[model samples]
Target: MIRSLKEEIYKFIHQKNSLYGLVALVLLMIYSALTSKTNADSLISVFGAIEWIPIILIAIGSAFFAMEYSNNTILLLLYKNSERSKIYIAKFLTILLYGIVLATTSIITALLLSIVLKSRQYNLFTVIAGKTILIQLGLNILGMIIYSLFAVAMSFMLIMLIRVNAVVICIGLAWGFFGTSLSTALMKTLPTISNILKWNPLNMVFISQQLSKPHYYRVSQLSNLQLIMGTLFYSLLFAILGYLLFRRRRV
Candidate 1:
């Protein structure tokens, strides 16, 4: 199982498109580092601008799964003596690995940018040292991981229902965005809706960057157990949904 999983992961990393995307991301990092303004507003603008990574990640995650199945390579794997269970878990881990890679890229970009663009207003290094940055970075990475894996779940889920994975890929982004935007808004009239929003995987990803900073938003005096419990519930749902879909899938 480990060997099979490792082989698939290796294949995922070596794919021509994946390699190119990594290269593009690296180049962007360099560009960001060099082009960063030596001012405060520009520094804030840089971190704020990184939301694009999640959008790209969602598209990539969908394509990653769809490409395997649509191209018939995944079906071939089933014939290679590997169990569906192993493959399912492998795919899950691969998406998580992909998210980590991208999240690392984002962090590296930010760290380099912070060093180059460090200022009185954007003093990330001085304001936050090793422990602080580690905490903040953990939140950022954790948030991205959740969303990216959710993308993987989405990609697998949609590919089973639709023939073309690209359609799902396109719709996944829209769904993700819409899901995130409506989560909090819907909670108002529908008390249940509010409870449901807590499990929204994208919330931590979108708000992690801001929430790490104390002064930015008011630290609520009230506890939010619903949100915490909802996250756990939704995560379980994502796993079960993927298992059910792939277990019965033609692949």
Candidate 2:
């Protein structure tokens, strides 16, 4: 397992997509910071780049696996490792690691931009929406991590099933961008079962919103703890399904 993980990490580090993704994320943070209209907007913009984490993870994770099959390197990987489970887990972990790197970059870039652009507006200790900026930033980061896990796992499952990177990227991006809105629309259209529907994986993506704005609980119809658990459950579920498909797939 350790050897497989090391190999996966090495591959991820050498991938051009990894560097391009990082650069794109940083540029997004700069754009968000520059376009803020007020102090509150600026502060919120500090975490704005995080909203793109899921989309970025989906693209990178799906492309990583799809590249393996397209290049016929998956056969070499299986021949060398001989343990499909190890390879799958290692690849998943590496994707999660990339998510962590992106999240870290978002936070750091946001802070630097905030200092340069709005140093006098508010400090990290400044209170906003009843919580300090630093605390809100932490919660947002946690939410991004949870959502990224689900995004990466779901992309893996989709790629394993379809073996088409472009389709997988489109599906993953649609879910990442619209899943929460779709969940909200469904709940309103079926208010009677909104309670049950609130537990859906799509609604769990609102964990950050509820965590930062406690009043958002009315919209999500779920507590922060519930959203966290639901996101984790779906993440694990998709990961298991993806692994099963990968193991059964013919090289």
Instruction: Write down the lDDT of every candidate, Cα atoms only.
Output: 0.58, 0.84
Model 2 stretches with alpha carbons more than 4 Å out: 44-47
TM-score for candidate 2: 0.95
lDDT score, candidate 1: 0.58
Mind giving the per-residue lDDT tens digits that candidate 1 earns over 1-251?
78877987898887775665566666765675566555543343335334545555556655676777778997688888557888778877776677677777766776677675554453444335333444555555554555555556656666656747568757765764565456445454466555454444544333433434433222221133333344445556767786788788875
Q: Which candidate gets the maximum TM-score versus the true structure?
A: 2
Clashing pairs in 1: none
Off by over 4 Å in 1: 23-50, 118-122, 125-134, 191-229
Q: Count clashing pairs, candidate 1.
A: 0
Query: Could you tell me which 10 consecutive residues in candidate 1 have the lowest summed lDDT?
Result: 215-224
lDDT of 1 at 188: 49
Residue 185's C-alpha lDDT in candidate 2? 99
